[model samples]
Target: MPQFELANWLPQVAWLILTFGVMYLVVRAALPKVEAVKLSRAKVISDDLGHADTAKTNAQSVEAAFQAALVAARTTATKVTGDTKTTAAADAAARLKEIDAALAAKADAAQATLAKSQAKSLKSLEAVATDVTGDMVERLTGRRPAADAAASAVAQASA
Candidate 1:
């Protein structure tokens, strides 16, 4: 009933108009700043995303270059390893050949010394056999065997 009273409506209408006008002016003054802040935030986010994309692309390119360098280094290392192995093998073969030749010479000298020692031992053995045979014959038959005959007897027994 109070809302519908026609006599109180003029003051209510004036108050409503004043409040609406103040609210409109306040909103109108602040709205452009709010919109500007929102647009600026969006632009900053877009710029950051663009920069991230560019950084990612640069990182990819750097990775690609690093991979290429690594491949090249590996190839070079393989080649160097192969070359070193080949050189070492060749050197080892040469040294082995030299050592074999030296060992063969030393073996030949050792064989020559062994042959001379054997010959000396054989001559001394023959002399000792002749003396022992002469003494044995003298003890058994009261006569000593001749040196040449004792030597021949020893040679026959040995054969």
Candidate 2:
């Protein structure tokens, strides 16, 4: 009932106006600071994002450089390995050739010794055979053969 009276309407209207004005002024005063804080936060976030992008780019570049270095190292290692293998093969070939030469020389010396021994044994066998033949002939015929004749006959028979 008091709210519906005409006498209370003006005071209510005046209070309403006062309250709305204070609220408007307070909101207006705080709006710029809020906007400034929002903008500062946005700028900070944008700057952080830019720094992250720069870091990402730097990481990519560093990774690429590392890959390049790795490739170069692998290439150098392959070349060195190939060179070492070639050197080892060459050294082995040279050593093998020297060993083969020595073996051949040893084989030739053995062959010469074998030939000399064979010649000496043949001469000894020839002398023994001649003596045996002369003794056999003397025993069978009761006459001894001459040494030169027996030697000549043995030589002719062998030839």
Which is the leading candidate under lDDT? 2
Task: Write one digit per residue (lDDT tens) for candidate 1, span 1-159.
Answer: 898899999998999999999999999999999999999999999999999999999999999999999999999999999999999999999999999999999999999999999889988888888888889999999998788899999998877
The alpha-carbon deviation from the true structure for residue 102 of candidate 1, after best TM-score superposition, in angstroms, is 0.8
Candidate 1 — which pairs collide? none
The TM-score measured for candidate 1 stands at 0.67
Residue-by-residue lDDT tens digits, candidate 2, 1-159 = 898899999988999999999999999999999999999999999999999999999999999999999999999999999999999999999999999999999999999999999999989988998998799999999889999998888888887
Candidate number with greatest TM-score: 2
Every model: Cα RMSD to truth: 4.1, 3.5
State, as a TM-score between 0 and 1, how close model 2 is to the true structure.
0.71
